[model samples]
Target: MTGLLTDVPVDIDRDAARRAAAEELSDPKYRDARPNFLQQIGQWLGEQLEKLLDGLSSAVPGGIFGLLLVLVLLIVLVVVIRLRTGKIARAAKAERAVFGATRKSADDYRRAAAEAVSAGRYDDAVRDRFRAVVRALEERALLDVRSGRTADEAAAEAGVLLPDVATELRQGARLFDDVHYGGRDGTEAAYRALTELDERCRRARPVAMAGS
Candidate 1:
């Protein structure tokens, strides 16, 4: 009886086992069992991008206003600087014009004195001619050569470069002083001295002009 049982067949359905295994694998719960790391990372990146966009939108208006304010301030500063520079430039030009006019007047008077001496106008030479030369220099602000200044004082202030001519200038001034204040008669000698002084003034004019 034990030997006969060992030769008996067993009933097993292989197709049914395979069909059940396929059905279990095809279930929605089984198919979606594992978490997808790539999908999760994609979702996180999308959320981060939305937050960045929100922050930029919130800041844009204020940033634009600040940039506009800075631009306006810079423009105003440039305009103010330009205006101030123009005012200063105009003031400088006016000063130069005044100085040039004064210099021209001084040169003209010097020339007139020279002409008077050359023409042998002695009486006119001592008074109008020599006086014109001194007045012109004073008017141009070259020196403080005034009527009140003594001949010696004027000559001393005139300096070493003008020493040779300084004596002649002093003599002319002395003659003018004698005629005007000292009640002395104008003579040919006084006239000659005036002519010499006029020559000295002519020579000194260019030097003074150059210095100015």
Candidate 2:
């Protein structure tokens, strides 16, 4: 009773310590092992099915019916998971379709256009400049050009976000179509016009709606 340890007093708030530990374990930012929602849902469904089957096995007094029920439940779970996964895949594919299959960045296309201008390949410059415009619009979420969409379609969509440049965008889109699809050679003036529109759009900001 007279030991040094007994002579010294220690204070511990047991409830506070327990609460701190619980918070540390439950906090999302600190918890490193969070379960995926889909996987957790599947597991919970399986558990519920297992309990139902157990009750059925006891009440119905037959192994065959329980086995059949388990199989049906498993098939249903598989179908649900597959449908969810397929929907997610389709959404991803749709987003990718908006931007098409180009790996080049907007800056890359813009630089290519400048190089084409220097080489006096006015048609090529026009083509690249129009591509740069589309890429920029896509990056800015101004246009959502899906597969098979024409330059005019892209320009029209972008015009909703940038109405001030609608006329120039339409003109630039026509020039691109002419040089690319209509077998017409592009002139410096045409390429210069596209370049000017591209610069304007790059610097332009969206206008606020009247009522919102």
Candidate 3:
């Protein structure tokens, strides 16, 4: 038994065996199968964030329970932000003027609208073009220049005077409300509609009333 054991020379030491295994696994196939740089970065970041959160949670009295509570709070915050800035945006348009309280003339508003359209800010273009329409009506004595008059009020008042373009006026008013206060993205179609409304209004004469 002693001779047989002595004859069997175990040349593979522990460190040497480890080295051999490492070299074998260092094959191009193994390296190619590993994750790329971006994937590795993402994985490392996830692991670091996990470690940080776990450490924070462990420091709290409720440990993992506290981590759950924090995650819930974060989710709630995101939801609230979406509601405030993304979905509902702000309150009714009545709280503001149709022309945004600016004292620009109808021509000035038209120029402003053109600039906004050039800048690709369709929302601003729609607002400015609609304001130009309202201001033109006021200048021509078609509608009174009342303070705090909303888009809806302006459209209704203008419709009474300009019956031919009543529907278009109401549509432009709704577009104004939809884009400005309803958290909707303005589009070129909406801007063109307003532009057409402005042109039609310019040529429109007041409806003849029985008393007049």
Candidate 4:
């Protein structure tokens, strides 16, 4: 009975039918229903993660725990790579931006810097400390909180507000750029100097502008 249906002849224009189907699919509703680029990327990563887990499931001894350990290690490795490699800036005329995706309060930055110092990661400490200084200036209303503001820009602007600490602000900006963009190592001495600069900026009140 099924073979009889195959034997039936129908005048079907395959090209016209294909074109009709394509026209229907080109509708805005169909296009809107499709996954976006970011969504597609997320789905791809999820599928790859599942595949990796399946391969590890056979060789891993502790069942779920072993698989979870592998997942955790992979996450850590990726994070370490991003943190270490993301700091180096390509050759550009403008200095790199000071703040990153994660923004913190001034005190929070101080706490993070102290932790970095305890871990002997002076580079991290210096970066955090310099951020604290800039954030503190913003909090004090000496500088406005502008997105994508570079270190030199912050220093130059803040220097205008606090005349006494003007020289230190420029120096601090250069130090931050050196360690963060120049791919140079940060030292405890540098961190201390940044801390001193922060203190000076805090102590020195913003001077009144001319004709104000």
Quote each prediction's TM-score.
0.34, 0.50, 0.54, 0.54
TM-score of model 4 vs. true structure: 0.54
Q: Model 2, 129-154: lDDT tens per residue?
A: 88888888878777664565577878
In model 4, state the lDDT of residue 159.
86
User: Which residue runs does candidate 4 get wrong by more than 4 Å?
Assistant: 1-95, 209-212
Residue 45 displacement (Å), model 4: 54
Instruction: For residues 54-164, write the lDDT of model 1, one tens digit per residue.
Output: 666566566656556766789999888876678775564343221222333545654654566677754445555455556554654555634344434544555344555
Query: What is the C-alpha local distance difference test score of each model?
Result: 0.59, 0.79, 0.87, 0.87
Model 1 TM-score (2 dp) = 0.34
- Prediction RMSDs, each to the true structure: 23.4, 21.0, 15.5, 19.0
Clashes of each: 0, 0, 0, 0
| Per-residue accuracy of model 4 over 1-212 as CA lDDT, tens digit each | 98999899867699988998999999999999999999999999999988877778868978768988988999999888766656532223234778866679999999999999999999999999999999998898888888778899999998887878889999999999999889999999999999999898878877774345
